[model samples]
Target chain A: MALDKRFIGREYGPFVYTIGAEKLREFTLAIGGAVPGAGTPGEPLPHVSPLLHDAQAAKAGPYGDVIAFPSFAVVFAIRPFSAALSDPEMGIDIQRVVHGEQELEFLDVMRPGDVMTSTGRIADIYEKARMGFVVVTTESRNQHGKVVVTGTWTGVVRG
Target chain B: MPRTFQTGDTFTHVRECDRYRPIYYAGASGDFNPIHIDPEAAKAVGLGGNILQGLCTLGWAVEAVGVFVGDPGRVRRVRVRFSKPVRPEDTITFQGKVTAIQDGRLTAEISATNQRGEDVLKGAVVEASLE
Candidate 1:
């Protein structure tokens, strides 16, 4: 079934997320190929930057604090897209949905303790090649009201 | 010394999706969708088995550019199309080429391919600030 185009422009969130130092380290290591064990996010890999996991180095380096890996914004920025997928009104079959594409723009380095508020809306709903596509565009701003990140999330529903 | 970037400069990064990667990533990223954590649930959904989240692959693409620019915080943008699922034990190689440098920003095109020579991401591009 095709998604109803009427849902276009429907909005989701004001979702708020607070960046934490440990969580930022965990995400950086996990994506950097560190294997986790009980109660540990594993050792940081060589390619993983110290600015992302080491407090002292980061404090001495450029950002003056640990910085979230740019893509780490997805942790909270995904709220709106997730909401739209699970929205009963959209009737999207979760089991048949796959992330089709993603685009993210980081305007500034995200640091621990930064409070980010994100809001997104359904940008488009359409079908092609028998697959239904849902497009969601999001913008996240810091507590200072500065735009920190913008995202375009696309999900494809398999027929 | 600041690094200089030019069009056609290429870099590479490789990562293996270990058996427990999806679970670890789910814990880290808060994406616990069954298709990423439970093999049985993924099979039920006709996915054959659990798959790594597409965002993880995106992260790798960003990492490649971050490494090239010598600072993760300098990365400004990334875009990718998820063309195929990356399963456990799959090793992915990301190759990035500097495609443009203008003002203070550098743009690169990246390709993500699995051990089987299958493309997992298409039309991937990443941009980073040089200053």
Candidate 2:
């Protein structure tokens, strides 16, 4: 079944997320191939940058603090896209959905204590080769009112 | 001394999707969708078994460029199309080549492939600031 075009312009949020130092380390390490346990986010892999996991080292680096890995923005920036997929009106079958594509632009580095507010809307709805595609565009602004990140998230609903 | 990058410079990064990596990524990213954490659930949906979140693969693509540029914070943009699912134990290799550089920004095209040489991500591109 095709998604209702009526939901094309539906908006999802002004979702608020506060960046924490530990969460930043966790996310960076997880994607950097660290295995986490109850008390640790695992040891940082060789390729993992110290600026991302070591607070002291980061404090001495250019950013002056540990920074979230660029893609860590997705941890919070995905709020609106998640909302759209589970929105009852959209009636998207979660089981049949696959992330088709993704694009993210980081305007500035995200650091701990930054408060980010993100809002997004369904940018388009169309069928391609018998599969339905839902495109959502999101903008996240930091507490300083500066745009920190923008994303284009696409989800494919398999027929 | 500042490192110089040219239009044809290339770099590579390799990562393995260990059996529990998807579950660990799910915990950190807050994407607990059963397809990523539950093998049976994924199989029920016709996926061979549990699959890693596409965003994780995207992250690796970004990591490749981040490593190339010598700083993760310098990575400014990344775009990717998920061509196939990455299953547990699959090792992915990312090869990136600088495609352009102008106005203090550098752009690179990246390719992500699995151990079997199957492409898992298509048209992957990343941009970073030189300054």
Candidate 3:
């Protein structure tokens, strides 16, 4: 079944996510953003090799606390976006979909401990040569109701 | 001091995703799609093997911009199309060329290619503050 064009304007929930430091640190390390040494600066472990050079200044550098990577918003927004797109009511098949593109606009930096509420919407739907495309956009706002980031995910579902 | 960028300025950064990159990205990004984390499942689906998350590749491009701007927050906007699937152990090279720089903002045309010279990302554009 093709993705329903009528669901283009459908909106999803305002899911709340309280950012955690451990998650941030994990993402940082996963993206190779950890401070050059084996451990954070000022509190280096004695067991770490002293020959380790400061490759990327993660800890003792700028961005005081752990900050989310540019694409980290996906962790917070994917669930709600998935729920919105995979709804049986939407008549969409999740198994045949492939990510086509992405756009992210960072309005403000997201730090650990910040609480954010994310809302997802189907921005557009189009079909081409037996394939269906759905553009999902998510807007995440901070505790103060300030927009922190906006991400657009484009999924192409093969017919 | 803010760095001044001129049109045509170019820089490139490369990142090689290890065999476990997809799994780590799946865990970190919460995108556990079979094609991204399970090799067998990926092959069954015709993907040959587990592939890296598109967002993770985008993160590398963002990191390149961060290195150029000296701050990640300066990246105001990033747009890119995932032209090809990035498999594990694929070395992605992110290249950028300054297309515009005005009013304390810089815009660049970016592209990424795999070690095999295949275009993994196309029509990529990033706008960042010149701080």
The candidate that achieves the highest DockQ relative to the unseen native structure? 2
Give the residue spans of candidate 1 off by over 4 A.
none
lDDT of candidate 2 over A1-159, digit per residue (tens)? 588887888999999999998899889999999988889999978998898988899999999999999999999999999999999888888888999999999999999999999999999999989889999999999999999999999999989
Give the CAPRI rating of model 1: high
Per residue, candidate 1 scores C-alpha lDDT tens digits across B17-121 of: 999999989999999999999999999989999999999999999998888888999999999999999999999999999989999999999999999999999
- DockQ each candidate and list the results: 0.89, 0.90, 0.52
List pairs with backbone clashes in candidate 3.
none
Give per-residue lDDT, candidate 2, residue A41. 91
- Cα error, residue B33 of model 2, in Å, equals 0.6
Q: What residue runs in model 2 are displaced by over 4 Å at the alpha carbon?
A: none
> Using alpha carbons, what is the TM-score of model 1?
0.99
Which DockQ-derived CAPRI band holds candidate 3? medium
Please identify model 3 stretches exceeding 4 Å from their true place. Answer: A33-64
List of chain B TM-scores, one per candidate = 0.98, 0.99, 0.95
Error at B65, model 1, angstroms? 0.7
